[model samples]
Target: MNAFRTLATIVGGSLKNNATIECDDHGAEFFKVEINSSMDKAINHPDLTFLQGLSCRDSSSSTFGPLTLAQLSHFECGEVALSFCMLHKVGDACSAYYFLRDWARLTRDPKSTLSPPYFAMDSLMPSPFDGPMVSPVVEPKMEGCIHQRFIFSESKINALKVLVVAESCWLSGRIEKLPHLFPNSITMMVLSFSGLTEDPMPILEMLPNLRNLDLFRAYEGKEIISDNNFSQLEFLHLTELEKLKRWLLGTNVMPLIKGLGIHNCPNLKEIPQRMKDVELLKRNYNKW
Candidate 1:
């Protein structure tokens, strides 16, 4: 119990804090911690339903805290289960992954160094109001929900891949002639070319209806420029762009983009200024 408490303290920031949102006021909500000790060796089983009881649940109140921690220890089987339930308003799945990773690292070695958490979302996307905030009402209902589990073994996955490859060959033929045949009809594109020395924007911009673009090691250039293209693009993902240093977007490019993701772009220095306030931006880099 002491070790878990120390672990929680090490993950200090918002996980340790409680927040409450009301109609016209914001206050501290309950940060509940529950510890359970059981002698039932069934907790050592791989059943999913048994794991659900290890976490805390508050069905009585519609509003709850941003974080909840539950620790379950089985004395007979000598197993410990630590569960965390964090609200999406506090952070997303990636945030939870990093939190758990850092906690594990600290658990192994308390002196290990970690990258500091970034908490400047308000500065990046500021709210206009300075007065009391109004919380949206959340009504919980489970009327017609059905849950089922599906398992795909390795052989099944390989069979599906065979089917996909047959379709992909036909799709590849269509994509090769896409610019001349169906530029306006194609709405999504994924390009990955080896040793591509020229800019791909000029060729891709012709597809006026393209809404999703994913470029993975497609261009081996220092810079990429887009000039008034991708008018209907809603999401863009760039991955493994090793040499991309600067990306420039025109005033009218990607006007409808809602999500932008950059991964393994070690040399990307900056993004377009117009995309600073996109609804979702997932960026991962070794340097910047």
Candidate 2:
């Protein structure tokens, strides 16, 4: 019902499906989240960055493996910064976004009530290829498109009602003005707000020195900046972005990206027409 509750539902579902992971000691074990006070502390940490492999096409593939001490040292305590990790395209971007946001909200306020994640399992169609491997454990089927589902208790669900109501209240005005720009689903709308942006002005004003970027899809003509310039972006993400035709077509291309994600965007199955990578396409489609 509320944003925080919706997040609980997702986490509940993830736990049910055996898709969740947790670490207690900071960098004592690889799975634990590491924290620091400065970039120098992050650099000084002894953890090693490891390459993570994926078994699906969902956001699950994007999860960062145990960071090297150097990478861990990058995090600063008490400073909220956006961090990037790889996920599989099969992992629901909406579910992932709500899960984290709600988790944070619950951590801050424990009395939140959440609703169950809508499980359209019957709608998901089974895969055609039974190969040893194919990306995204779940793919869009021509017929029924089944997706995994999860839900939290009514008590937890209720606690998040206020936050969800607040977001709905905020979004109502925007939706009324631009009815056509409504997101494909609630999950997309939640992610569009939660993720970071490449805009330096907001980052500089809100954060200390503009380190992490919470990039996500901007609706058609959202006016991120009067002039489109994102040359210093370290992260780029596309989440359920159905209308990215103009953004990709723009001449201002990003050069130095440390992380990139294209998630839950059904409208963009193919790369832009102009910048298409022929060899990568061949490899992706296996047209040798």
Candidate 3:
């Protein structure tokens, strides 16, 4: 409990200060922790059913400010499971992963040096637009949603890969009405493809609502440049681009971007000077 409380202080942002999210405003902040005892041993359940009793559920309509819920479950075999639920409005999956990673590091060695977490709510919500916001898809009600879990074993994954390899073909030509086809897509991830030689920003910036993008070994280029676009983009992550040496951005590009993460780009020596104005920028390099 003490460890988690300290984690909250480190990564909870406004919630650490007891701020809440309101209907028309933002203010009451609370972080809830619950502990439970289970008679069943974790070894008996190889499936995800074991998590059913170790997690907490939250509602979107709740007035809780920056909701961060944690559950600790103790089993008969003396094993413990810790679960955390963070509101999507407060942080995304990447944010959660780093938060948990830092927490584990802290628990292992309390005196170890840690990278600080960045919070940019003020930068994210600079000003409210005066008209009704337009959305490409209708929002679904949480009450009508059903939750289910699917597990894919190594054998199953290997079989699927074989089938995909047998049936796959290369595609060419420009795709029309791309935004109309994927209007609701807010996040995109690309990995392990080395054929892309041109800068991908021109095509990707065409995405009307894309907010988060992650690229890992997806391009085989020496340089990347971006124009003055990506008006709605908020976060960009670049990783393992071994050939990339330079990245340049035009003026007023990615106007709303709040965070940029770079990792394992050995040849990329410097980040854009303009990126210094962003609220959060994290870079990890293997070598200069």
Identify the leading candidate in terms of lDDT: 3
Q: Higher-lDDT candidate among 2 and 3? A: 3
Model 1 whole-model lDDT (C-alpha atoms): 0.58
In order, the Cα lDDT scores of the candidates are 0.58, 0.36, 0.59
lDDT of 3 at 52: 40
**Candidate 3 structure quality by residue, lDDT tens digits, 88-159:** 756677877877787778878887677766755444444346322333223347787899999999999999
**TM-score to native of every candidate shown:** 0.36, 0.24, 0.34
**What TM-score, to 2 decimals, does candidate 2 have?**
0.24
**Residue 230 alpha-carbon offset, candidate 2, angstroms:** 40
Question: Could you give candidate 1's per-residue lDDT for residues 1-288 as a string of tens digits?
Answer: 333344444232232112322322121122333334443534465342133543332433454432434333343345554445545545566766776677678778877777766655655455558522345334456778788999999999999766643311112111222233433566777765444566767777777778877776667778888986788889887888799999988898888899988878899978899887886656444422
Looking at model 3, residue 24 earns an lDDT score of 25
lDDT of 2 by residue, 79-179 (tens): 43332232332135664565555556676777876554554432344334553234334422446757778889898888876554332212311221222
The residue ranges of model 2 lying beyond 4 angstroms of the native Cα positions read: 1-31, 35-77, 80-90, 119-288
Question: lDDT for model 3, on a 0 to 1 scale?
Answer: 0.59
Residue 174's lDDT in candidate 1: 16
